[model samples]
Target: MRLESVVPLIPAELVAALDHSCGIRTDTDLLFFGSSLDIIKKLPLGTVTLSDLEKFTELVAEQASVPGHRGDEILAGSRRISEKHSQASCGVKELDDLVGGFGDSRVFEISGAKGSGKTALALQIVIQGLLADADSCALWIDTSGDFSAEKTAQLVRHFDLAVSDKLLERLQVSLGFNIEAVHDVLDALRNSLSSSRTVGPAVQWIVIDSITPLLLPSLSAVSSQGHAMMTTFMRRLRELAQTFGITIMVINGTSAAAPFNQSSAFASTNRKPALGPSFTFMTDCTLWLSKTKDMPDSEGPFSVHVAEVFRSRATRSRIWCTFQIRHGVLSSTIPDL
Candidate 1:
């Protein structure tokens, strides 16, 4: 009845196939994990089929309970009942109303050029999550070196939220200078997730403050491999989001484009997000952040930043909202046009 005796009874090909698909690095990975073997024990002894093993693998993955209901549960609901859209806000009313805040187990891609307040908004999200709940946690993968602790502190105080060690400690920051370092951080997260216990405040949010800089350097040199790596990284991110019910926001730099407000229709501008089509398809929502021409000192002192929901799975309505940084915090205004 022990796992060692049961392991030999299972076919090697089934194990190999599972390893390839599940990224099981070693044999120990297949045998270990406290609950995994428990599922396998239900199968008939000394006669394990591939179907049974596959079922066991699926049961193991289900350990990471998603925030939403399963497909079967959704289908079983009354036909007259409408699907509910649950979202978590970032403490910004206008922003929340626009994109329905950040949904659970979804990826939000914020595309903008440099100096377009991407980092500012990202910090605000972390602050919001911490402020929303005392135990809420967030992770910042600073590949672009744009995150600032001092500024975050200023915003935390600006909101009049308690600036205690516990609140500050809730937000974890990892500065990955190179792609290898980024991979290392992801590997650590994966390992941490394998355990049944909660790891590091049950991380609710993960922000990659601009993923372009890291991949852009090598993308030209090894286009195929670079694209593949980027895709894999995003896939792993998606898995993490689904498994941990974390909201992922990846900062993407956009190519410059001439301003075109010719028609009311949402036109696709030359300003494309980094990672091209592959990334667009993978993202659940894409928000383009752009800056209009600077206003004169008389018109307005601060520069205006517009956030357009160019692509979204939740709603088709094209939303255009404006926000400005005041006292190191972003204040979102009503939609303009």
Candidate 2:
């Protein structure tokens, strides 16, 4: 029998089985699943019931799934079974020991007041990824217009990339000031990826140096509508992260309203940074950077920024580490606190 003809005859139980096994969500429409009729031909006749088919259709319409074991519960059970099985990444040994490592398909939000080493960290990742020779390319969306060509050149020189000046030429740098422009650049990037099987090195990382400014103008009202818009924007970012299999690093600034205990914290609060409750929740990982004041005589005048990893899918509990930018390379000075 032709697959197309059998589509209508397939039982609901068979459809449900296909959906669960194929990771098809319940909301998938007939038109979408109809294309997969070929795969439905393998089911035996009379094995599935019309009632089961109806249930499957209903589930698809409602975008509901059969309840089963929760993922978190499974992980907790496994962790209990094997105490040494931690999900942390292979970050720099010392740093990774504390906050774990960056995870694949995750959005990491780094927020701090100005001059808080956010850009430095972003640059560091770009250089490190290049050094790792993961065939990795980086997309740096300079939202603050602070990305420096000279600085990038300095880092390239400092690390001494292995690629010839010609292949190194493939490393593209895009600069954008407004959100629309940034979106346009991203669209171009997506198109490039679709058009060519091997267009430059496989892009593995994307950094938006300071996403706050791009979102600030639209979030002035902070109403439900505004929040919805913000959510949509973040969803797009998440989509890009997944589609390209790239790690997304967004630099965010804190708002003035966040409560502060010390004079320094109060001063930081006055900077009028971005504010949105969902910002913290939507991110897969969040790192808060704050300046350390009243350092001992041994420490320099430069504000010491400490990194705290909060809300990560794969990270360590060792929070609190110091980072410094030397010779244009951002390096961790002390291990975990």
Candidate 3:
């Protein structure tokens, strides 16, 4: 089936030649409708005709221009479209209630300074998914060289999640040293998910532990180009979420607090994330982790970490919760709540 032969098979009247300069507008609507009507009349009726009618109506709605009529037609005849994905518990009841858990088909951001338990949270998300289903799996892209198998196993054991060979086989881990490596890993993951018909049911979560390291190399050298690249990468992550019906968690490191200078007020506000506006704009939810000061003495083995949901589209109220990490497992600090 050569393209040339296929082209000749199409009705010459339907095909527009390069030299044809006629505009498709109100003046030519009748001619266009006549051509389309003739083509449809040739097709088999019943199912094909009914199925195409809806698509044709949508096409007409897009190009319609009957002063206020387009809105009415679309509203009355068309259905609202939205991405579909399942929601899973984030291992903490308060956080789950705050943001409706980690929503599939959405990008969630966890930003914080060093030793803020960002990686610990990400690993627990994987464990949670596995706990939900024995066969459930997750992908971890370690851009910061901090992913630990020992920690993962400890979390699985402490949480009593699936720890069999089959469960381990389902989980996929890839090390990404640089931005190019990260892109390559994402591409490979996308292809694998696309090829497998049952990927959505098998793979439940994907985490990029610390996206800041991948951008640090170019942040000072080519600021504009670096931002553009970061935007592209974030967009791709969003697409992967929507297309695969999976939750995406990206860990981002924040900038160091500026030296206290009484002369400048803006110096104190420099505690934002490293990548800036583009990264935050793409995420559906952004949570920041900060170490709490002067906590009451407790006999617990692990210290408590606080999470603040500063930006989120899923919930209206501002939320803050305290959780603890012990032996790689995470749990709410307040047991009564």
Give the top-scoring candidate (lDDT): 1
Question: In lDDT terms, how accurate is model 1?
Answer: 0.65
Residue 325, candidate 1: alpha-carbon lDDT: 62
TM-score of each: 0.69, 0.63, 0.67
- How do the residues 82-152 of candidate 2 rate in per-residue lDDT, one tens digit apiece? 33213323224444455455535567887777667777777666566555654667788887667787777
lDDT of each: 0.65, 0.58, 0.62
- The per-residue C-alpha lDDT of model 1 at residue 25 equals 30
In model 1, state the lDDT of residue 186: 71
As for TM-score, the candidate ahead, 1 or 3, is 1
Q: Mind giving the per-residue lDDT tens digits that candidate 1 earns over 1-337?
A: 1112224445555555544444443223443433545534543455455567666555434432334667876444422122111436666677766776775567889887766777778778777767766766788999867677887777887775556556778888999877667767776766575768754566778888768877676565434655655655676687777666678898888754447332113465546677665677778888777766444455345567777776787655467777776555777643552
Angstrom error of the Cα, residue 323, model 2: value is: 2.7
lDDT by residue (tens digit), candidate 3, 141-206: 887576778767666666664454445666789999887677677766766776746444456688
**Candidate achieving the largest TM-score:** 1
| lDDT ranking of the models | 1, 3, 2
Name the lDDT value of residue 26 in candidate 1.
Answer: 28
Number of backbone collisions per candidate, in order? 0, 6, 0
* Candidate 2 global TM-score: 0.63
Error of 2 at 132 (Å): 1.0
